[model samples]
Target: MNWMDSLFHELQTIPEVAGLAAADDTGTYIAGMNIDDTDEFAALLTFIGRSGLALEEHLGLDPLVYTSLSGKKIKLIVHRILDYFVGIRLSEKSSISKVEGRINSIVGNLDIEDE
Candidate 1:
């Protein structure tokens, strides 16, 4: 399997995840499923996640890891991977910790095209 495939596969195992997408820093979709507009959504998600950097600094939380947004029906998560960002959409009812650990395990091993 491709590097992205490994990441996506692990993400898929998460009980709550309904969609997954990986986008380069430039916001190009690399892999995913069920997202309405991968390109646009990736860009938006990238911006949102990166933006948290400033927020983290403001809040004095060093070393940003990931960011999650919970809505009434869904939970969205984004992680900054070297030169890309991974977006996951899941059912709000599920526990994020279950998938978070899996994600962390696979991210460092991902063999992407660039970096």
Candidate 2:
């Protein structure tokens, strides 16, 4: 497996994640699961991540680590990790705090990319 694949696999171990995907800084789909249109999703993730960074800059706030949007049936959590962004889709009722810890753990242990 590639680096992104391994990381995504680890993320899949989280029980609450119904779907997940990753995008590079350029908004290209790196890897994903359960997402219908990987290209569109990746693009959306890039837009969201960029917008967050722009807003933080304007407000003089700390860089964004992650963000979430909740809907009636699903919750979308997006994390900016290194030069990539990962989006996790969870059931609306899932415990976000529980999943956040696991996400951080996986991201924290990310291996250095092969040179």
lDDT values, one for every candidate: 0.77, 0.84
Model 1, range 1-115, lDDT digits (tens) per residue?
Answer: 3666778887787677888888776767777888888788888777877788778989998867788877786677888876677888877686676666776676666677653
Best by TM-score: 2
lDDT digits (tens) for residues 1-115 of candidate 2: 3767777788888888888898988999988999988999899888888889999999999889888877786688888977888898886789787788888878778885671
| Predicted model with the maximum lDDT | 2
Candidate 2 lDDT for residue 79:
89
Pairs with steric clashes in candidate 1: none
lDDT of 1: 0.77
